[model samples]
Target: MGESRERLWTRDFVLLTVCNLLLFLTVQMQTPTFPAYVKEAYQANDFVVSLVISLFSLAAVIARVFTGEALKTKSSKILAIVALGFVAIFSAGYYWAGSIVFFLLLRILVGIGFGMGSTTFPTIVSNVIPAKRIGEGMGYFGLSTSLAMALGPLIGLGLLNWFGFGSMLIVLVLLVAIIFPLMHFIRAYNQLPVSSGNAQTVTGIRRFYDKKLLLPAGLNFCLSITYGGILSFLALYGKEAHIENVGWFFLANALAMVLIRPFSGKLYDRKGHIAVLPPGAIFVGISLLLLSLTTTESLLLVSAAFYGLGYGMIQPSIQAWMVKVVTPEQRGMANGLFFNSIDLGIAVGSVLLGVIATHSSYSVMYRWSAACLLLFLIVYFLSQLAAAKAKKAAVASENVGV
Candidate 1:
């Protein structure tokens, strides 16, 4: 029976994994290209380009808050399908966008679909996987995004070279179209039994925000702020620095993340977050700082390696930590909150960093990123101290009882 259960669980995980990969591929296919498209179409300035990058994140943040509520009342499978349909429609629209305004508008609409679809996968994963394996599973699950991050843009660029931007957009649309049919397989994964009680009840909603979970969520926010800067402006920075083969930097980062994720997941499962998080944080900080100082392409690739390692490790650790502290029934909402925090950070970072870049040099942006990382480190240590104190108190209480 145990073996049978394991097999069933594995099957479910596989299905969810495939779905995540497809969704991430759709996301990545456009992410790196969108800014270039906007720049070319609108002759946009820094602020406008930042807006183009941030619009999706802002919309996703707003959508993430409410997506949890919808998850409770509706079939997540259908919601996912609807979201993918939006992605397909909006992606196709890119081909026909006559003005920068139309492009930006479609990007915002894409964010809405992205928000809904992105949130559902993790929620489904949490439901299907066992509690003990959640961290490991989520770590493995994140590789889907990492993989897409690595390949999607390269593929997009390749398509662009061969066929043009319109053709690349068409390919993305077609890829997105595949997701609707894939929803059938995903339905089985979502069918894992949910708790009988109403998740919408006041008490249930209150329980979703575990104080212990907030530490990781906060960390997620900070980490994403740093990442958002990279994602939104790396291409621009590369241009400023006169770095050739800028796409390789992204590729290197994604490849490093893909290589490191499984190990990081296992480390998180075995060693706890304390063992995994700080080194990763330090590496990330150093990477960003180094990126700020670099003029050469070689150094930029070095920064990518460092950043990728740090980001790959930190992301899964925080995600695992967030889900680990929550109850089974509240996992969806918890995941919702987790993702929303990320969106919030990304949205803010993209907009603010854009403003900063406009006013100053790109190098200053990295300096600011370093400062954010420092702040994150401080918060992380404080959380560790608080956890230690709580542990000591629990030990004392046990001793007293004895």
Candidate 2:
């Protein structure tokens, strides 16, 4: 009976995880394919092609601000459904978008729909998973997004190459439409409002940005910068390094993530972020160093596994930390900021590392990218120091009063 309550694979949890997976698949499938489609179909230059990617992400990041607030109340059932349906509608509209302007507008609308749905799904999951198993539950759920990230682009590009852009849109619409039916049967959204406490008092913009989220979000941001570099430049790096079938890196990385996530989560559950973060950061930094000099496909995949293992450890730990620190009602906001940091970091990393690559080599760029994690380590340790100092001071104050 005790084990039953501790269960992480309840029906609704699985349903919500699937729903999250499909929605993210819908988004990520577009990530790599859209830039190509826009350049070819519209004969767009670099700036316009860039907009095809950035605007959707920027809009999605912005949209989460409002959607996160709405989710602070009753769970995001209605918001998510409406937003997802809105996404499907806009997605289908892509077939008829006459100009690049029209297509970009459609992308923003879809991004909003995506933003709303993304925030709601995690908030619902946070509410549903057993308190003791939040780390494990979120780790399992995080796999959906990670897997989609790994698979969606491959699938999207295949659909684009084998079929065409229009067919891909149709498939995407149908995929999202399936989520609507699934939502009806899902009963996992049990988030009650933060009825009392400081949560009730905070209003307007302040309510949306919780200070407690800053350190975790910042660390997540730093980690994402390296990922952004990978997403934006790994293929180019493959070219530079003269490695054939560089795609194997992602394959190995995905495999490593699947293997490592559960153990990382369990470690985090038992020993907190300290157990997970330091070693995870070391693995990632070492992975980047290895990738910098990777000359063979075998070495490339080995580097990927290290990266996957480190990332699998850190990301869920940060997310679970954010969820644990917040009140139940604030989970949506926490999740929103969590995702937004990733997007923002990715954007920044691409631009920052691109400049470095322009001046130096891809190998050098990767070296600099590893330095982001060094910053991650420095910031993490400093925060720990500050927290310890605060705790010591509080203890001394109590002793003095006694």
Candidate 3:
């Protein structure tokens, strides 16, 4: 009975994780490669290159609104299938992209599909996970995403170099296509809790965006901004710095993420975000600083390890914190909003950092990325102080009445 009460590794959860892993793997593989591709193929500038990531991300943010609403009462099966359809079809469409504009269009359409798939998988998993272990389960679930982010670029750049862009797209297309059959095994699609978010009295824009999720969502946004810079320019930066095997940064980062994720997730569950976030942010900030100043492969990889450690700790804490604050019904919106923050951050970071790189250098741009996290720390501490004051006031009021 006790085992069942805390079961975090059910079949449903595993399948969801795999589907999400594949979905994101396909997406992240393109993240670092596309900028270089757009530059070479289209003779594009930094602004146009920024559009490749930002515009696609904004489209996904808008699409997730509909996805969140649909998941409230509709069949998650239908949403998942439609999302897969968009991905498989549009991914193959990349082969026909004769111009950069056309390719950006494809990215927009596919991101909508991504928004649907990304939201549905988490909503279903949030239900199936034993409520007692939401942090651990989500941390494990998050591994699928972090791992994809970690390894996809190394594989993507390899495919681009060894074969060609066309062959790389073909591989990613097949990778995405594989997810279709796996959907049949997901049995938790229809099992929703009775106390869903729809029961709350939220109205208008608030219906889709919850106030409770704002602070963590903001912090998550800042964390993703640093990564956004990495995704948009690391490949290009490799050339700028004359580094031959920059993919090693991602490989080394992946190793660190793999080692740290389990322990960080358990720490969040036992001690809360206080035990995890600040130190993790410090690791991320230091990594970006070191990466900016690094001139050799050894130093580059050391920076990657620091990043992986911080990112491993911080990302899951923000995600689990959002999930814990909302109702079962609102989990759809929570997940949607959670992802929206990430995509939006990526979008903003890509453009902002792209401009910095245009005028200065990628190294300078990374320093700016590190500085953005200062906003994260400031927002987090302010929220904590407010909560503490509110708690103190409540206690004082109760004592006077007594």
lDDT of each: 0.79, 0.90, 0.87
List pairs with backbone clashes in candidate 2.
Answer: none
For residues 1-402, what per-residue lDDT tens digits would candidate 2 score against the true structure? 988879889888999999999999998889989998989899999999999888999888988888888887644788888889878999999999999999999999998898888888888888888888888889999999888888888899999999999899998998898898888888765545444455466787788888999999999999999999998999999999999888888878888888888898888888899999999999999999999999999899989999999999999999999999988777888999999999999999999999999999999999999999899999999999999999999999999999
Q: All candidates: CA RMSD in angstroms?
A: 3.1, 1.4, 2.5
Task: Give the TM-score (vs. native) of candidate 1.
Answer: 0.87
Error of 1 at 45 (Å): 6.1
Clashes of each: 0, 0, 3
User: Which candidate would rank higher by lDDT, 2 or 3?
Assistant: 2
* Residue 325's lDDT in candidate 1: 74
> In model 2, what lDDT does residue 77 have?
81
| Candidate 3: 10-residue stretch with minimal lDDT | 193-202
Residue pairs in steric clash, candidate 3?
Answer: 196-329, 197-329, 197-330
Better of 1 and 3 by TM-score: 3
For model 1, the superposed segments whose C-alpha errors exceed 4 Å read 4-9, 39-49, 96-103, 193-200, 203-210, 239-242, 351-360, 394-402
For all predicted structures, in order, the TM-scores are 0.87, 0.97, 0.91
Predicted model with the maximum lDDT = 2
